[model samples]
Target: MANHVYTAAALAAAFFLAPANAQASPQAALPSAEVTTAVDDVVARYELPGIAVGVVVDGKVRHWEVRGETAAGSGERVGRDTLFKVASNTKAMTAALLARQVDAGLLAWDDPVVKHLPGFRMYEDWVTREMQVRDLLIHNSGMGPGAGDLMLWPEPNHFTRDDVIAGLEYLKPRWSFRSRYAYDNTLYIVAGEVAAAVGGAPYDVLLRREVFEPLGMDGCRIGEWRISEAGSVASPHVKRQGQWIARQDGEVVADMPMAAAGGVRCSLDSMLRWTQTWLAEEGDTPHSGWLSKKQREAVWTPHMPMPLTSRMREWNKSHFYAYGYGWRLSDVDGTAKVAHTGTLSGMYSAVTLLPELGTGFVILINGEAGEARTVLEQVLTKHFTAPGQNRTVAYYAEDLARERAAPESSAARQSSGAPVADARASAPRSIASSSELAPWLGEYRDPWFGDVSICPSDSGARFESANSPRLSGPVFNAAGRFLVDFEALESDADAWLDFANDSPDGKKQLTMAKVDPDADFSYDYEDLHFRRTGECASQ
Candidate 1:
C-alpha cells in the first residue's frame, strides 16, 4: 500500500493559501489495516476495475489509497494522479464559478437569465421571462428529471451549447415553475454559458482560471485533450457477460457540451484539495479572496426541497432533505452534512462532507460500481458519524444485502407469491410480424431531438436517431408492445413505443417510456413527442 499524506504546511505552501485554524485535534492516524481490508472486500465483491479513496481531516489530507488497475487487464495501476471523470460533481464547481461572478458584480443570483442570454427561452413564456440565474443550479425548474438530456450524452453527440439553449423552449414542464424538485442538467449547461458570457471566456477557460488554477488543482481538465497527452487517465468500464469490458481505448476526444453540468475530470489528489477548500474555515483558504463569504454561504444554502429516500432515512436518520446550489444538504445522525454523487456511464464518484465534524472523504471509481460506492461511502461516513459503532464495508455490505432481500420477503404476498422476474418478462415474448409493425414504420420528428426513423430491418424494424447515432437499435415486440432495444451497450436505456390513438393534426403522434424503471433519467425518452411526418427515407 502506498500511503500519501499531505501536511498543513505543505498544502499551504503548495497553494499559497493560509492554513485554516484547527477546529479539533486531528483524529488518530486512519486505521490503515481496517481501511485496506474493507476496500479489498469491496473491490473483490464488486469487481471494480479501479478505485481511489481520499480522506481529509482538519484541512489536511490524512489518508489516500489507490487500488487495482486503471482498466481490467490494462496493466496500468491506479495512481494518485489518475484522472477519472468526476461527472456531476462538476456542478458544485460551476456553482462556485457563478458565485465568483456575483462577487465581482458581474451577475446576481436572482438576475433574470434572459438579462444575460437574450435568446434564452422556456416552453412557457412566463417561465422564460421569470427564470433567474439562481434557478439554474437548483432542480425546481418544473422540467422533469433529466429532461432534454439526450442531446448532451451518449457522448460525442453533435449538440452544442447554443443547441441546448434552443431546445429548452420545447421541453414542456411537468409542474408549475419552482413547484417541486426534479433534477435536470440542461439548466446547468445554460448556467455555464451565463458564466462564460459574463466572464468574457469560455466555460472551460473560466473554470480553469477562476477555480482550478487558484486552488492549484493542476490535474483537473474540462475541455478537449488528446488521450496520449492526458497522463495516467483511468479507462471507463461496464460489466458485460459477467466480465468487465473497457468502453473506449482509442484516441478519439469528443467535445463535452455537458462540461458545466457533469464533465470535469480530476484526480484523487486534486479532489482532496477541492474538498478541503469547502471544509476549511471561512476566509482561511487561499481562494477565499476569489469568492466572498456571502456567496459561499449562498452556494450552500438550501434552494429547493428534495424527496428523502428510504435509504437516507434509514442510514442517516435524515429528517429533512433539500437541494442546495450544487450539493445536497441533509442531516446525518444529528450533524449537518453536505454532499453529492456523480455518475456517468461506467464511472462513479461520491463526496461526503461532515461540516460539523470538520472531516470529509471522496471515493472515485472507473467502473459501474454504484453499490460499492454506496457501501464504501457509508463505511467512511460512519467512521466520523458513528466512530464507536465500528461499521466497516462488510457491515454495510450485509446491510445492503438485507435491503435487497427485503423485497423477496414480501414476494410471498405478491400475486404469484413468487420472485419478481426481469421487468421485460411482463411484455409479450413473441416477435411482432412485419405487417403488424408496418403501421408504425415512418419518419418521426421531435422539436428538440430532431429526427428518428422506424424502418424495416432484418429484425422486422429498427429505430434510428439522426443526431444520436448510439441510440440506433432494433425494434422488438415484447408480447404485443413494440420496444427499442438499443444496440450501443453503453447507452443502456431501452424504451417502449406508445402511439396515441387520436391524431388531431392528422399526424400520428408517438411517445416513449423507459422499459426499465431504473434506467438513467438521461434516457428521457418520455420527453420525446414524436410525430410521424412521412414515410421513412431510403437507407
Candidate 2:
C-alpha cells in the first residue's frame, strides 16, 4: 500500500537523519537500538510535520534530536535553532522571570496583586485585598469559563495588561476564592507586572536580561506577531472530524508591556537551556546563584489543589496532583515533578522532570499532538525501570492497528476519528439503566452557576466545558443528587485527594466557576463544594 511505503520511508529517514549527523550521540544512549526504533515509530505514526525533543540529565543538555520537517510537506528541516511557538509552556518561563524578582527580595509569593499593578482588583471585594502572587499562578480565580478568554485568544483585543486588570469589575465570581484550582492566563500577566514593577524594567525586558540571556536562549523572544507574520510560525492544530487540521492564522496578542504568562518563542534547543536551568535548580546539584534552593523548593511545593483531581491523573499515571507556586507538582516513581503545560490555538507544549531520576524532557509540536504528557511518561518508564529498556513515541501504531481492528460503534468512532462520526445524527441513547442511573443522575442546579445535568454520555457520565479538551477531561459520577463531584479514578486525579464523593441528599451540584488555570485570582479546585439543585442539571 502507498501508506505502508510512506511509513517505512518516514521511519528510515527519522532514524537515519540525525544519528547520521549526531552519529551515535543518541545511539550511545541506553537501549539505543530500541530508542531508535521508538523514535522512528512515532515519526511514522503521527505524520508530524516535525518534532524537536530534548532530554536533560544532571545540569547538562544530554540528548537533542528532531524528525520530519518543521512544516511537514515543506523541505524545511528542523535544526537545532528551529523556532516553534511553545504555547503555554511559556508560562514556566514567565514563572521563572517572577522568581528572579524573589531572588532580589523584590516580591514574595504571598504578595498581593494590587502591590505592583495598582489598578488590579478582583470581582470579589474580599479577594481583591487578600489575593497573593501565588494565588494567580495557582488558579484560584473564580471567573466564569471563557470569561478571561475575552482578554486574549481571538487576538488579545486592544486591551493593555492594565485594561485586563481594569475589566475585573465586570467579571463575576464562579466560586469563593481559594475554593478550587482554576487555571487562568491573566494572572501570569499580573505576575509579570509584579516582577516588572519591582525590578524597574518591563516584564519582557526583565525576562530576557535575567532568564533568557543567562540560559543562552538568544533566539528566544516574546510574541507581537502580525497576521502577515503567520507564515513565520507553525500552524496551531486541533483534532476535528477525524483528522488534524491547521487552525487558521489569527492576529497575535498585541505587543503589550506585560510579560507574564504565555509570551516568548524559541527553538527546542533554546528551550532545553531553560529546561536544564530548571532541572539543575530542581536537582541536588543545582545551578547556584540563579535561584536559591529554598526559592526553587517553594516553586515545587503544594500551594493549591484544584477540585478536579480526577482529570490530572490521566496526565501522568504515576503521580498525584498538587500545585507548587506556578508549577504543577506531581510525583513519578517517587520523584518530585515541577511541571507545566501550554496550549495555544496552533501549538501544544509539555515539560516534565523526575528530580530523583536526574532527567527532564520537553516535547513540542506545531500541530495537534494528542497527549504528549502520557507519551513522555511511557518513554521514561521504559528508559529507567526496564533493564536496557527502550521506548519511543509511535506515530503509526494505532492508525495501522485501527485500520485492521474490529468494528466499533458510532460514538467510539468519534473518539478514534472514524467515518461513522462524520455522519452526525441523533445523540446516542444512554446505556445505564435509567432507574438505577436516575437516583445518581438528576436535574441539579448551582445557585452561583448554570443548569447542569448528570446524564449518561458515550464514555459514561462526564462534565462538558465548551469544546476544549483541556477544559473537559475529568468526568463526574452520577450522584443522583444536586451535587457534581469529580471521580478519584486514575483517569481523573486532582492535585490532592481522589475527591472521594459523599452526598447526604445526593442532589447538590457544583458548576465550573473558573476554568482558567492561569488567572491571578484563581482558586484551589478541591476546596469547592456546592449545595444547590436549581442552577445545575444532574443527568
Candidate 3:
C-alpha cells in the first residue's frame, strides 16, 4: 500500500550511482522499442488501476517497471516494490518451498501425506490408499472448488492437521483417483502443513529460511505483510458507482495459518527475483544458489495431464494448460510457458516464465476493479505477438463485463426479460425486496453441494452454505431462478438460482440457471441451465 524508506530522492541518487539495472532480457535480444509498445497497448486497452511489471532474460532483470496511479483517483504513482496479493500465485511459492525441502532431503516428493501428519486421510477411500506428496501438488486431491474455504473466510476458525484429514471424509472426488486435473487450494494448504511438519517449524518461517532469505528477497515475507513505511500500501482499487475507491481486504484473512496457498504478499521486484531463481540453470544463482538441476527438473515436470486439455487449449490457444508442480504449463512464443496467477480481494498478479529461453516476466496489478486475466493476457499478447502483427485478440465480452461489475454486485443481479420457464438465468439488475425474493428463498440441495439455503432477510438476499461463510447478493436477474452476484471473488465465482413461476394460464413450473448463463463458466454459456425440483415450501 505504500513505499519503503528509500525515498524518491534516494531512488534518484541510487539510479545515478548504480547505473540503472533496467535492461531488456539479456539472451533474447528482444527489441526494447517493441517491449515498450506491448506494455503501452495493454495499459491503455484495459484501463488498469496501476501495474508493476518485470522481465528477466539471459540472467538479468532489465524490465521490472511500473505504470498508472496507485489508486485510480489518486495521483500517486505505483512504485517498484508495492506489496501485491498475488492471489493463487501463492500456490507456486508454496510448491517451490516443497521443492526446496525435497531437494535438501528434508522431505521426500513421493512420501505419503500422512507420513508428516498422521492425521492425514482422503475423501475417496481409494485416494487415501494411493495418495502421495506429488498428488497434493497436483490438483488431483478430489476436493471440490472450495472444500475448505469455509474454515478460512468471514471468520477465521481453528482447524488442525486432523481437521484437514477429516475433510477427506467429506470430500466428493470428482475424478477417478488421478484421472483428471482440477485446481483446488485445499491441497496446497495441506502442502503447507506438511512443509511445517516436516521442517519442524512454521511453514512461513521455513519458507523464509529455505527460499526468501538466501535469495536476497529481504523485503518479501510469507504470510506476514511487511508494511512499506505506511500501512496504506498501494491497495488495489475497484470502480464503485463509476468512481475509483481503494479496497480493503477482509480483516480476518491475514491471521490464516496457510500462508503458502494464498496468504503471501510481496513486491514486484521480489517476485522477479523469485522467478529468476527458478530460471537459473540448476538454481546456481549469480550469487548463492538455492535450487538444483534435479530439483528444477522435478518442479517443471507435468506430472499429470489436465482434464479436458483440448478445451483449455481452445480457450488459450497458447499452452496445454496443465499443472506442472506450482505452475500452469503452456506454450508461448515457441517456448513452454510456466506461469501462475493470483487474486485476493482487490489485488491481482501473474508471473510467466520461459525457462528454456531464460526469459520470464511477472505482472502485478493493484485493485480488483479490473480483470487480471485480461490485464495479463494483454501483457502477454503485447510481448509474445509478432512485431507490427495485426493479431486481433478475441476476448469474450461477457467475461469483461463481469470483471468490471464484480465490486458492485448490485447491478449484475437483475433479470433482462420476462421470466421464462427453463430459460437462461437472468441476474437481478438491481436489489430485490424481500417480497420479490421471498418466493425464491429456500433450501437447495444437490448430491454435490449437499444443502445450501437462500434466505430473504430485513437486509437483503443472503446465501448460507452448509457451513461456509454467508455470501450476499442483490437481485440482478429474474429470468429463471433468481441470481445474486457476490461482490468479492475472483474467477467469476457466482451462484445459480431457481425460481417458481405461475403463468397466466395457471400452469406452475420451477426453473433454475446461473444468475446469468452469459457469464457462466459452462463451455457453452447460453445452454447453461439448472432446474428446480421443489419450491419455497422447502425453505
lDDT of each: 0.82, 0.55, 0.59
Each candidate's clash count: 2, 74, 35
Model 1 lDDT tens row, 141-199:
99988999999988767788888999999999988998878999999999999999999
Per-candidate TM-score against the hidden true structure: 0.91, 0.63, 0.72
Indicate whether candidate 1 or candidate 2 has the larger lDDT: 1
By TM-score, the better pick of 1 and 2 is: 1
Each prediction's RMSD to truth: 7.5, 14.2, 11.5
lDDT of 2 at 468: 18
- Regions of candidate 1 where Cα sits further than 4 Å from its true position: 1-22, 25-29, 249-252, 408-433, 490-492
Span of 10 residues, lowest total lDDT, candidate 1: 1-10
Compared with the true structure, what per-residue lDDT tens digits does model 2 show for residues 35-143? 4555556656666666777777655667666776655455667766766777567777777777777888888878877777777887777788898887877776775
Candidate 2 residue 360 Cα shift, in angstroms, is 1.0
With candidate 2 superimposed using the best TM-score fit, by how many Å does residue 248's alpha carbon deviate from the native? Answer: 8.3
